[model samples]
Target: MEREESNNNNKQHFSHKHILTRLQLDEVEEITCNACECDVEEEQFYGCTDCKYFLHEECAEAPRSIEHRSHPSHPLTLHAAATYSNQSFICDACGYVGYGFCYSCAHCSFDLHLFCSTLPHTIPKEEEHPHEIQLVCEQEKLLTSDMISICSFCDAMNTECWIYYCETCNFGFHLNCMISKVVEEEEEEEEE
Candidate 1:
């Protein structure tokens, strides 16, 4: 059985070919979003029951283009896939490879993962530091050595992933590490 629900303020009408509906999950299912190719493991999602197209609630509601703080020079546009190839894209925010949706700048070839595009501009200062951690896009020309830089949290070499840096402390964090930290902090606050 199926049910139709009214579109909320967040939902945008993409096309008439697909009638998107909100889906309620009763149990865990391995459903992937058609837009970002990420797992729809959340309790609710928007989907096209007829075409089997699905999107995470956030992805479905994301603006067509946004002026991200990280890349202030130009606005990033949300795209189903890379314009040039069907191949995976390297996320400029996290530095990881992704096959799904991306927020990209056509002029600079800069791309960020759909979720990464939503990361906050700054993070609260950790106990070890006195200043707020700022999310930055490292410049390729700034690399003085061919060696990889180690992430302060994961202790992994940052060969291609995005990084969080503190200029005063000369400290750096992997984008994934920062994302996890933010999530953990939010969860902790929710519990209190």
Candidate 2:
């Protein structure tokens, strides 16, 4: 049952082809995160045999800095994992528990999703929404303490989840929410 559950979880996490491919292991490649203990497949998350720069796939995609579409005023920069004063971060993506790799606007103290920070400046119209997304910076003065926007993909308020949006067409979606939804749908189909 344990093996069965593990197989099921792997299927739920990644497409069969993605997960089934044999891992490319090398003696030179160093193990990065022991906490997650996830294996490397085609492309490594972040690593170099010579230097010590390494991160999880989740971490590599994390925004060192970004301009969010919804809260465009100032650029959201990635802050190293640290304890926050009053507000703490919780990634709606992957449901990982930690307090680093957060997106913040130095000008307005705006918080955001790390995955949202990694969103492509221009999204494919064929994916879901039919529009090109350009990064938008929020002006410090215009930003309110509260976030007021809805995710076009999940149809949820964009409070904790940051988003990608096309201003001309008004198309928007949460970065991680969209990925999760697709993965969930695939798993549901497999179960059926």
Candidate 3:
């Protein structure tokens, strides 16, 4: 009986009781991650059929606190809801306004999107570039002129999107551009 009890305990400890379960496409009706607020139609996701809680597998597994290079002064804590009265948050990393799960610093009022928080520190240099591109967090200060900061990769004016910048070369890239570039590279590698 003691051996059986021990086995049960082990199973309980190893089981994904708290983890979300993957659902079939047919099973995914209109569920979305409470964390990132992204719909299941975009990607495969995990969810609770009973409680109706859902999360992107990545969002569900995000670290409770992270020591991001962008906010080196203190570690940012993951928050399911904003503690402030504004009911919204603007990402310091990407410059986009959102109302969802965020990595936040209460002391500094710094916020980052889940996807922005998980961005890689460095990316391989594009064929046109001579050095590896480094990610830098730049705060968008109010400009008096109508001019806009342009993305080094796409040559488009940076508006609400997050930017990855290299201090050494003064190069910048929009978050979407970087993500797409990485995806394209991965697809090319898979083909090769």
- Strongest candidate by lDDT: 1
Clashing pairs in 3: 94-162
Best by TM-score: 1
lDDT (tens digit, per residue) of candidate 2 on 61-83: 44355656655567767765423
User: Which regions of candidate 3 fall more than 4 Å away from where they truly are?
Assistant: 1-22, 27-30, 41-44, 127-130, 138-149, 153-162, 166-170, 176-192
RMSD of each: 5.2, 11.1, 8.2
Task: Give candidate 2 misplaced runs (Cα > 4 Å).
Answer: 1-54, 57-77, 85-98, 105-107, 127-162, 165-171, 174-176, 186-192
Q: Please give the TM-score that candidate 1 achieves against the real structure.
A: 0.70
Between prediction 1 and prediction 2, the one with superior TM-score is: 1
Q: What lDDT tens digits, residue by residue, belong to model 3 across residues 57-142? A: 56766778899877789999988766679878987766667677898998999898887887777877778777787665544331
Clashes of each: 2, 8, 1
Residue pairs in steric clash, candidate 1?
94-162, 95-161
Segments of candidate 1 deviating more than 4 angstroms? 1-16, 126-131, 138-149, 154-160, 176-192
Give the better candidate number (1 or 2) by lDDT: 1
lDDT of 1 by residue, 1-192 (tens): 453454542344462256677876546457788766766778778877677777888788778899876678899998877675666788877767787778889999989888888777677886778888776655562255443456788887764666766767667788878767877997899799
If both were scored by lDDT, which would come out higher, candidate 2 or candidate 3? 3
